[model samples]
Target: MEFYTKPGDYDPINYVPHQASHGTKELWKTFWLLLGITILDFIIYFVMPASGLRNVIFIFFGIVKAYYIVGAFMHLKHEKINLALIILVPTVFIVGLVMGLLYEGNAISLMK
Candidate 1:
């Protein structure tokens, strides 16, 4: 019998369930991808450019890493496209707003 046959049995805040293994190959692939992303992030941090361009590149890589983390490692890629968009839309909007604010703040500071 399934342990979590009933959906309500899972707690919203602290429920931890065993991950469904997608076999050894998938597990290895996920690990390798994660390692690669970490390396890329380290490289970016060391090669830091000016703030504006650096942030843009960092955010770009961050989004890519997030995509892989959510889609591949977390096994959500096969789900509906709308589900993925739902998770990302707010994040994208917030990032855009932050960037706009930063740009505006820099402009204001320069005017002084």
Candidate 2:
């Protein structure tokens, strides 16, 4: 059996597809937005005293950052709705489960 039938056959081992350059505008925007969010998080961390509200604020910011990172950098925003939902629905449920667990644990600790 011959591995390659012809002289100029396709080589699976040495395949590098050509990719066009997409503009960096969207990337720069994502960078700036992430930076602003980080700065805001830092300011809020120092300005607010340690409390439930402060923690909630931090969580909110974290979720926002995660959403932006996934949507922009991961290219999920441009994906079809079904594909995005497939990746995101379980994530939402998992986050909800974690928050619920935290709330229940805090309540149980208070009762102890």
Candidate 3:
């Protein structure tokens, strides 16, 4: 029935929000970490040899970025393991499906 208690009833150990200080710090840390990874990816994109290997590297970086973005920004890191796996398992399959499509499309184009 009641949300906020009286001044004397305020208990630090009993109440904590999702966006606590630790969570905020983690969010910023994730932001900077992702920024660094993106910069590194760009450098690799320009410096690496133009080949299938480079494309695979790009896909690997993409998967890593997606994992961090989903876990941190989407707050899946705090979720239960089974719940997180529910989303992640389908995601792995989707990524595989995309890679297969790309390979098939490239083969078709080469045939043409």
Candidate 4:
């Protein structure tokens, strides 16, 4: 609200900032990214193969999607390399555990 100068005049010094830009570009970008991931997921789900190629392709796409989400969308690009690696420490351990389990699984089947 503006202040009255002399009960008959109003002060014009008071003003409000301009409203933010009007656009939906960012929203559309996010929507498209999500739609793309959804389509990839559907494709991965219905297609089945007995060879290890399927697993390799699945893992490749999974890593790509993860990198995009974490590196670009998460705004982690400005972070230091050490910081990023610190966050990835858990992934390293998880991958190691998965490898160990796969080895054990194969060994057990062989023993049987």
Candidate 5:
């Protein structure tokens, strides 16, 4: 069929939208925060004896880092609440499922 109406109509193939460049301040902040969390994770991993508590601490740190990464890098922080919830709610359930599986698996091993 016919796509363009007139001589100078908008061309779909050669459309170039102008995107404003957001500065690097927020990116630098996110970088530093992620780096700090990584350093903390390493320190805790080395200093703490292997135990359930240590595992929980690592999980908590992981969630925190994931949140920051999604918020800053993925631009979820600027999105609507409903959109954010749509992505986060399933993640919460999955993490719960994993924790439950770990607990049950450990219990089963103890019985063997």
Candidate 6:
């Protein structure tokens, strides 16, 4: 399929230049926020004690980073809330499943 549009035949309704800058700003803002989260994760790695509490902190930061990355980079934030929720709900369920399995494994190991 031919992807390139003819020079004068561009569709302005579907692609508006004025609104494009807004998206760029959001992208950069999300990038900076994710970088900050990464820095915090690194700081926690060294300063926090190696305990379950530290694990929880890392998981919280990881979730925040994932939210922004998916929302902004994936362009889901621009879509309707229902559409975003449709994609996000399954993701959250999968994370829950993994957490449950890890908890069960720890419990079984402790019982032995």
Q: Write the per-residue lDDT of candidate 4 for residues 10-112, one digit (tens) a residue.
A: 4355544334443666546755776787688678767765458877877877777777677656645546789888898778899889999999999999999
- Candidate achieving the largest lDDT: 5
Q: Is candidate 1 or candidate 6 better by lDDT?
A: 6
Clashes of 3: 0
How well does candidate 2 score on lDDT at residue 31?
90
- The TM-score that candidate 2 achieves is 0.73
What stretches of model 2 exceed 4 Å from their correct place? 1-21
| Prediction-by-prediction clash tally | 0, 0, 0, 0, 0, 0
Q: Which ranges in model 3 have alpha carbons more than 4 Å from their true place? A: 1-21
- Candidate 3 residues 20-82, lDDT tens each? 444488788889989988998899988987898988888788878888899888989988899
TM-scores of the candidates are 0.60, 0.73, 0.69, 0.58, 0.72, 0.71
Candidate 3 weakest ten by summed lDDT: 14-23
lDDT of 2 at 40: 96
- The CA lDDT at 24 in model 4 is 60
Q: What is the lDDT of residue 111 in candidate 3?
A: 98
| lDDT per model vs. reference | 0.77, 0.85, 0.82, 0.70, 0.87, 0.82
Residue 101 in candidate 2, Cα distance off native in Å: 1.4
Give one digit per residue, the lDDT tens place, for model 2 in 1-112: 2355676886877755454456889889989999998999999989999998998998898889898899889878877899999999887788789889989999999999
RMSD of 4: 11.5
lDDT value for model 6: 0.82
Candidate 5 lDDT (Cα, whole model)? 0.87
- In terms of TM-score, which candidate is strongest? 2
Error of 1 at 79 (Å): 1.6
